[model samples]
Target: MSPRPPRRLPLGTATSIGAAVLAFTAITVAGLGSFGAFSGLTSARLAMLAAPEAVEVEATLARVGITAETLAAAGCSSGDATNVGADALAHLDTTNWNALVSADGDVRDAQAEVDRLGKLVRAGQADQEDLTAYATAKSTLATETSTRDGLLDALYDAAVADLTSGETTLLETMHGNSDRPVPLQYTVSDRTDAQWTSLRNALANIKTSGMCGEDPDTACTTLVTNCNAETEVATAASNLDSNLAGVTSALHTALGQE
Candidate 1:
């Protein structure tokens, strides 16, 4: 038979594990056990942590896409998606990322509009001959991005969904556990991998969908934009060298990141 599942806390609920840590420390000093205050921690906690990071990933992804879009929207032909990478520097999960989770709806909406317009211009959806079709594509693209951005704003904090979003249990008994701190570097690396996979997919789609404007079709060239993005985020993560390097030797280099 399959093993019974685990339980988790809820969003807007009182988990304050930080507070629980202090309580747990006091309890331990008083000869109490380790499981009292810091209760119910499981492998699932990593998912809770990654959600916020994933949200950052989404933002960074959006910004990069937006920069390319902005350039496309302006009808300029250059791969200087640098502005997009620069924009993401403000909110990488490398530092305190929870702050970014509270972005307003308007900001997301504007970014979304930019994404839509960029896709159209890059895909050559707008032809100079058919002013009507070009105009329609531009307008529709703008609206698409706006709605996309608005959608993300609502689900921004949904990271905590892992807190219990997939689990339910009235009673939780510690079966087997580890006191090990979730290797943050490892988590960041995993997020980097996830981001890379996403980039690869986008790179492929941009070409197949003809969304990247005119270019010599090559796999490496297609991902050139995302390669830089991976490097930027990796550099940000590498900023905390000591925190991650000691965790794993793999952290020393940014491989498979592009």
Candidate 2:
């Protein structure tokens, strides 16, 4: 005779069977005389499972603010871009850069809430409400991170533009010359000779280093140093002109030609 087909339990019957198994487990624990120990072990196991996730979440939240701050600092320091010139500085909005400060504070608060919820979960005292709150805080942190990243992108672009314009202006001033003829008698003094040499050396260094070409931030710094050198060159040139004019005037006065 063929065996009768095996019967499948109905939903209600299945639920009863599950309950019986749980009850048997409880009975076995009670017989062991250490049910409390078993419960503690189960809670500890749950906490161990949840701890790593909580730590990872906290680390992610921390990075959101740190990355924003680092980008903002890089943008602001790109080359004294704010003070170089009105047209150049106008390209950037320095005020909005402070947004990271508030965003970081909000992220820290969210992370603290997550930690509290994580503790409750570890202790086996958390309800659905605690988990739900943790999820909400995570969502808030994500939003803050997105906002911060967007602001940083805009600020970085503006800073680069400002630095580029400033670099162009510095280069023009260094290379361009006056069209008027200078007197042959207006020779440079020993001090002027040294100043001219220094300026030439500064320009040479800038050319070899490729200032404002490859890395704008580094180029901006080189430009500042060169600007000071250029000033010295201008002063020396002006002194030579003045000395020449004095000599011409003295010759004309002696000849009674004036």
Question: Using TM-score as the measure, which candidate wins?
Answer: 2
Clashing pairs in 1: 112-145
Supply the TM-score for candidate 1.
0.21
Residue by residue across 177-228, what tens digits does model 1's lDDT show? 1111221111222234455465556556556657546653566454545454
Query: Model 2: per-residue lDDT, tens digit, 138-216?
Result: 7876776566555544433433344444333322222122111221111111224454455455555556568546533
Misplaced by over 4 Å in model 1 are: 1-39, 42-45, 48-67, 75-79, 94-96, 101-257
Candidate number with greatest lDDT: 2
Taking every candidate in turn, the Cα RMSD to the unseen true structure, in Å, is 22.4, 31.1
Off by over 4 Å in 2: 1-95, 162-258
